[model samples]
Target: MADYYLAPDGSDSNAGSSSAPFASLQTLLSALEAGDTGYVRGGTYDESGFADGSDQHGTASAPIRLEAVDGADVVFDFGSGDTGGLRLWKCSHWEVRGFTVRNAPSYGVYVFGDSTDVTVENVTVEYSGGDPGTSGAGFHVRVSANTVLRDCVSRYNYDPSSGGGNADGFAVSQATDTVVEDCVAYGNSDDGFDLWESTGQRLSGCVAHSNGWDLDGNPAGDGNGFKLGGGDVPSGGHLVTRCVAYQNRRRGIHYNTAEVAMEVYNCTAWDNPTNFYFTAGEHVLRNNISSQGTVNIQDPVDDAWNSWTLDVGDPDFASTDPSSSKFLHLTTGSAAVDAGTDVGLDFDGDAPDLGAFETDGGQDVTSNVNPVLKAATPTGDGDLAFTAGTLHYYDGSRWVAPPVSYYDGSQYLTVSEGVQTDAGLVDGFERGDLTPYAGDLGSFNVSTDRAAEGSNALKTAGGRSAWADIRSTEKAIPHGSTFQARVYFTDAADSAILRFGVADQDNWLGAGYNSNESGIQLSESVDGSWTELGTAQMTPVTGEWMTFRVEWGVDDPDQIRIRCFDADGVELGTGTTTTSANQGNTGYGFEYTFQYGGTGPVYFDDLRIV
Candidate 1:
């Protein structure tokens, strides 16, 4: 067993001791033997990358450990276009903790190719990918087994290429028995947690929000909060529980076209395109809450006691605002409180709350005296009990106060002298018996008649002369800026109008496909008056499906572009319109309307809002 030291001001030729440390972590890692420990002092190391191949693998009994020095902040700034930061390839039995990786052009911490028993804790990866960068994901694990990431944060990772489609906060591909707990992913350009072709994975006590967009408010990527599965084959029977996803650009918890069954429990989703879009898999969803969003469930064996199934209106959350400290917690008199079936998980009430946080006498509070003196005190691990008078807190053992505040990227905020807010556990369950198809306030029907791609399509009741509308409420377009919506429509009516409407804007942006004339027109309405911007000639045949696309504010912020394509993807017509100052430019919500001159129905399919 040996101990090594690394510091920014040290030299590699000196002895790797505390007094004379090495200059780089790569030098120290190369010199480490089994049962060796390396301590990196507080400083920024501007390096390209660090990797340990299979030849440097450590034994289980004598693992290699690398950690930041106590009471120090170690940062690795891999500036622009580096392949990776802190890479462990085909190695085993390694422990890494307490470090920050910033400005990585690609992945921050990459463990790939048969690495086993690798544990990472209290690490923060931020600003991972940007312009002039390639596709990257923070904390990427591929084909690695027995990997654990605890109390980590992946934030603000973006990939400018592919419109920020490939960058994710945490991506695990074909990793077996990987566990991610007490982690947070925010402001990522793609999905928060993407499990692509990954099996034997478990995600718990994780928070993912504000993904699928960049900091500048540009909408891009799939924007799913938790994308459970994807790839050529259906590759997941993953366990996801006690997770919270909100304000994501797309689905809060998306199955992502996986055919495998996923077990999701005690999760909360809000302010997303669709809270739970489990259309492609046999998912089991229970005790989950879809507050302020839509739910689309296709095939599920066990779906019961969910907020949508129970019809428990609003969950009466403690606070709907994410800026509040008590966001998404079940409050007093909430219908979701104690409305769950015991699924062998811990709870505060007679039963578990419908969502993530259980309100045990309000976990967040400030008191003058000791909270233990109160009749109902906090017992959860992350329960906050701060005494203003004594400036002390219960660290799950005793009351002690630290000198200064320190965030080591762990479950709790630590301070000097190793004082923690509470026990190590941080922000801290089954799916059930029901039919395949479900319904919500939108009253959308799954029809097997005509579909653009899938086996089923959404159908609405026919309207005589008035417009029948289907609006996805709470599905706000990111920044209300540029986006593209595509839908396929077909009907027997000779004269019909299919239009996509912005949520609250009174003006009609344009008609998606108007068969009244032999042309397609993009128009804007001001003061109930319509003005055409551009038009293209095309005559459509009745009873044939055609694709309609609307590109809103794409090139110009106040512009609307429309395109029509035949079933074979050949362009039929195109139109462009730029809105004036009188017309609203920014719109978050959206809807679609269908109107036929005859008393009949128009079928729509494969609706995609991106």
Candidate 2:
């Protein structure tokens, strides 16, 4: 039960104290016993003289810890020839934290051979596999039980031999009671998180994105974002909750041919080529969202409240890119908000959100009710008895506290208010019909390729000429009405325009976009004389989605307010202007026009009027 120090400048024969620190990590680790703590000073520990934890052992109550001192930067540079940076072979009750290990030939940290109670936290492992002949992983744990890996990042590990056949960020094999939480893995040549032959493993609040690609952006790997199990193994009873997988080259979350009982709850999969592909597993999926992908799930599974079966819109994640550190926060108006089942989890709204990150502004009703309440003891009739967190009402015969499960399958006491429904929804395109609207020179059809809500969207293909628009049939528009719609562009059109408002051939007061210049234009036509009131830059990316909102007759009959939002629902630009008064309009709808010879297509969904 002592504390030792390791520094780069000291000698191995030193006293191993703070002042006279041991020079090498091997020396300090060799001397550590149960209840011993080694403080690594701020310096790079080259792999040439690194410590191995094969013979070191510790007890559960007095675990050995190797931690960076005072949040100092400790680097374990394994160079390119070493097989691994930190190899803990058959070690028990060891904790490693706050270290960056990189450039190992095989793995950054390897825990092998029946290791137990190993905790790795706040560590980063990168660039672990440079050898073509050997497979590598950032953090590889095999035959380890009761291991916890949290607050860690693994990225940029590859195996060049088999085109990254066996490279992963974090891999757990033959392990039991393993928990991986709050970890992120990206840019790996193979799967981000791989679990094989593991039982009773839980992964929560983890994110995996953009994996299965080499450093040169080549797709030379099998890029499943989170590969729970595979290889004809009996990996069973794994739970994955609140995890996010996005932009991986292959399926976002794949339970591939693992004949086991797996459960996934409140996970989000987005932008991957094929999201949520489960082949031969007995899976229980609840409240998960797969936004963009070909979702293929086999039989023998219980899927409930998943976004794929509901009329769900885009998840509207706060930031799709991990660089923003706001990867999966639901936007204010996201359909995923409050769309999950209440399964004894902490949630902000009436229920949990369908994704990893819940929006912040939702109300938490759990705290409003008193967990500890006093009730009158049942004496004769119509009295309530409170005991063990439950209140029972005596009906003169038996004490009953109502049915525990509500008709809708929610806990009676834990159920908050009803799920919030969107108001002023004019057309969500959920009807999957184009008869309500009319197309002029363009072709209008309902497409399932992409949508902001539901499974269908209004797809418009422009004709050979410009201004080939699609307009609504005959919807009345009142003064001071606000209109909004989500638009998705399949490709770049130099001169595409999407408009919504009271419109006809001559008298039109609406808002539109000038795609050639990437600007939003608010215009009104008075007796066929079109006047452009204002313009603002809102260059949307090609093949991306954006929201457009307009308020007509605000403050005055001629005043207009225009706003635009990116996919994340962040206001990109806004403008307000006053044009000539023209308030006598009866027809309202949307109009989209594309020029570039009608080569590209645009989708519109979630049209609302308020």
lDDT of each: 0.68, 0.72
TM-score, per-candidate, Cα-based: 0.63, 0.59
> Which 10-residue window in model 1 sums to the lowest lDDT?
426-435
Residue range 206-302, candidate 1, lDDT tens digits: 8888899864447878899999988976577989988888989988998877667878988999888899988765678888999878988875546
Error of 2 at 355 (Å): 1.2
RMSD of each: 19.6, 18.8
Candidate 1's C-alpha lDDT? 0.68
Pairs in clash, predicted candidate 1: 302-432, 302-433, 303-432
Kindly report which residue stretches of model 2 are placed more than 4 angstroms away from their true locations once superposed. 80-82, 131-134, 360-610
